[model samples]
Target: MDLLKKKIQDEGKVLSESVLKVDSFLNHQIDPILMQKIGEEFAARFADAGITKILTIESSGIAPATMTGLVLGVPVIFARKRKSLTLTDHLYSAEVYSFTKKETSEISVSKDFITSDDVVLMMDDFLANGQAALGLLSIAEQAKAKVAGVGIVIEKGFQNGSSQIRERGFNVESLAIIESLADGQVTFKEEVVSR
Candidate 1:
């Protein structure tokens, strides 16, 4: 997590008070080594949760989710933003609004990948508005799957996403939480150590 924080500090671009672009080493051009480390960390955090599957959205969430699945020895399922001809009609769908894109899209997951008996762990690249995660959660609920927790790579803490998820009674773990991005500066929420 320190490595990730350092990476953000070094290469992350502050586009504005509400946007921090980490495409250099995260979503756009990925760092496998860092992703592996992130996966291992998520696995460690959710080691005893009896996770049967890892759920994520397409594109950005795939890398970290795949790595987490590898480390946890579980299969990864990603929700598709766009429906294709090959995708079957039998799918669980939900509407999600992207904070960055500022548009709404329907995300869907095949019913064959998830089941009522499975314990699912949701993973994402960023948690700003929590819409994507919520959509994934809706899919899981539709499948009657038990959601163990959510693992986020970076959380914009200034947003209400994490709190919304927590209020819904799900455990949310974030690798790096930005408390603020005011004036093109990144500030993180201090980790509280429990004695």
Candidate 2:
């Protein structure tokens, strides 16, 4: 994850004390090589979880989740923010508040994609308020799927997201955790070696 930390230091922009924009490489215009590395990291971390599927939200979370799925040889399922006509009524839904957008939206996943037999590994680009992960967990619960773990690319450690998820007994792994983003500066928490 040193490579990822270096990438953030080189390209990430701290918009404010609470926002770090990494659209240049992480989310908007993705760096597939970095994503592949991230996927490999997650695959290594959760290698013994018996994961059957990777789950994430639509849009931002899809890239990393897909890459992780590819590495783990598991299917990826993303929760759609907007319900479409093509989707059937048999779905599991939850309301998630976006830390960046500052709005709440209903996220849904088709029941057919997840089932009781699945051991799901949830992945996301960022973890701020833990709302998205919570929503995904809700969906997984609705399907009776066992949550294997959560893999996050960037975690805002100043926030309570990580602790919240941990309190719920979910094993959460974040590649780079920002301890502070004060005065447009990014400070990371001491990296825990996890090869």
Candidate 3:
């Protein structure tokens, strides 16, 4: 994921000591090539997990989830932030506090998309507070689905989210881990060579 790490370092902006704005190529105006590469990376990491579905929250997680689905040849199931007209009555929901937006939001997914027979690989653009991931995990649990793993594009290592998820005993992999964003500087964990 050197390409992504380099792109972030070159174009990403440090909004504050706690935020790294990668809108230039990640969250906003995305680079399709990089996204495909990221998808492949996630697939490779979780290849042995026998993933049957790719789960993600709506908005930021869509692109990454779609790519993962495409690469892994699995269906991408995203949880909607709000109840929509197209949604069915049978659903699994969880409340999550978004640290970035400083607000609480509920994410929901139809029970039909998840089942006890499936193994889910959760993907996301960022992992800060880990609330979103927790919410997804909750939904998976309700459906009795086995969680294969968690794949994050960028994890804020300074935050407690990643550690919290790890403590729960599930495998969590992050492409780029930010050690800190202090002093208006963005520092990332040394790039890991994908095996």
Clashing pairs in 2: none
Q: Point out where model 3 deviates above 4 Å.
A: 83-88, 191-194
Listed in order, each prediction's TM-score against the native is 0.95, 0.95, 0.94
Ranking by lDDT: 1, 2, 3
Cα error of candidate 2 at position 149, Å: 0.8
Pairs clashing within candidate 3: none
| lDDT of candidate 3 over 1-195, digit per residue (tens) | 777788888998998888899887778788888889999988888989999999998788888889889999999998989533345479888888876677787788888899999999988899998999999999899899999989999999989889889999889899889998988887888765657
Which parts of model 1 are misplaced by more than 4 Å? Answer: 83-88
90 Cα displacement, candidate 1 (Å): 1.0
Candidate 1 C-alpha lDDT tens digits along 73-177: 999999889633345489998889876787778889888999999999999999998998999999999999999999999999999999999999999999999
**Model 2 CA lDDT for position 100:** 74
Q: Write the per-residue lDDT of candidate 2 for residues 152-187, one digit (tens) a residue.
A: 999999999889999999999999999999988889
TM value for model 2: 0.95
